[model samples]
Target: MKQLISYAVAALSLVATQAAAAPVTYYIQSEPYETVSNFTACPLGGCTVKYAKSNRISGSITLVAPLGSNLTDEDIDLQIHSFSISDGQNTYTDAQFFVDVFAQSARVSTDSAGNLTSFEFKFDKTHGTPYGEASYADSKAKVSYIWISSAPSPGAAVAASNSTCQFRGDNVNGNTNGAGCMMAYDTDSQGASSASTTGVTMSLTPPPAPTPVPTLSEWAMILLGVLLTGAAALNLHRRRQTA
Candidate 1:
């Protein structure tokens, strides 16, 4: 009877250990940049030209958990987001705009299991000017320089044109997480007082299961069962000797 009890206790201990070994899961979200604008200008016929600035550039980022992906605060990272410039009527240089994460009130949240659950960013409309320049010349006339301004006065403007979010960690192969963990500006030019937005999605794939650790209770129960079995065998041996 003692031996049977010992075996039953051992089985119960094993079951408890397995019950505590369930896998962990995580989810995360990212902020959206849906408001952006700037201005540009060009020269025509050796005369100064002016252009009206239009604000119509913005975007968002979404991260998805890959088949075997796991995310931790220490392993996640991001880079400055920027945008390029183009005049529907002229040419311009691609400029790098820095995102003000703090000003935009950007934040990332996670679940109790340490999984990223949500992310968001709020953009503020600050006043500012957009400017560009181009040279002009009449047929066979001496080349002259021309400058154009998008706004009458320069003011505070949204800092970033392109943006990127980088998730670095083990098992993250390049381009394997759907969109490769990086997102940038999707427009060609900066304008004034308008909203243009784009979005990218990424996933966090968890790696293989980790090695299990036996809990203290499990160890105690195992030890008790072994001791009980030994004691029972010793009693049985004594009874046989007497018989």
Candidate 2:
């Protein structure tokens, strides 16, 4: 009788698993048609303009329990990956950006001579809504990028070290801020000669909500199973006594 009850429990467990649904998956990407700005450290007591003119910003996001498997703003954890940002000449990887943004840190990408190429100071996810109506909702997350001149800049050399403003410098930090030289960067996003294309997209649908516990019918069936097994045991005992 005990063995019968155990078997019934195992059978119910299987049913519960089969009834449970899998969270769907969705692929997301975006295009930030905006220009970002950054300011270099005033080593010489002056600030230089640095900007990341977004050439193309795209990535994919996996959302759980999303409607229409749509990746909308929800109280769910987001697993975003495969992101890339480019400014025609230089490119920034997702690892160098999102990891720091989610971790509440800072990331800088540069070439040789410690010159800033593209850097993200603030991570903002409120920019564009890339989705369709009644299809799936999406969070229009956008981060601005600034474009800067290459390493060994002439302005840094001319301004930092010259008769106008005599200043000393050395390569203490890596390619981040142009070796303590104030550098001016340019990012033009609002103009006729700007990048025009479709917005960043988060397609391939998304995941659904997780399954809840078993229903009332399932519990009733469990009770029925116990009762039937107990009854069978009683009948078997009676037969044995008659024999």
Each model's lDDT: 0.30, 0.31
Model 2 misplaced stretches (Cα beyond 4 Å): 1-24, 29-56, 64-99, 102-200, 205-243
Per-residue alpha-carbon lDDT of candidate 2 for residues 1-243, written as tens digits (9 for 90 to 100): 999999999999998765443343433223333543333222222122232344343323332322323222212223233343333423445465323222111233434442334322212111222311111111111222322211232211000111010111212222221112122112122110123233333345432333567789999998999999999999999999999
- Judge candidate 2 at residue 154 and give its lDDT: 21
RMSD of each: 27.5, 26.3
Off by over 4 Å in 1: 25-179, 186-243
**Tens digits of lDDT, candidate 1, 58-172:** 2222223211224322222232132122222222221312211111222344555644444333222111111111111212211111011112222111223222122211112
Q: Which candidate leads in lDDT?
A: 2
Poorest stretch of ten by lDDT in candidate 1: 141-150
**Looking at candidate 2, what is the lDDT of residue 211?**
57
Highest TM-score model number? 2
lDDT of 2 at 202: 32
Question: How well does candidate 1 match the true structure in TM-score terms?
Answer: 0.21
Residue 141's lDDT in candidate 1: 16
TM-score of 2: 0.25
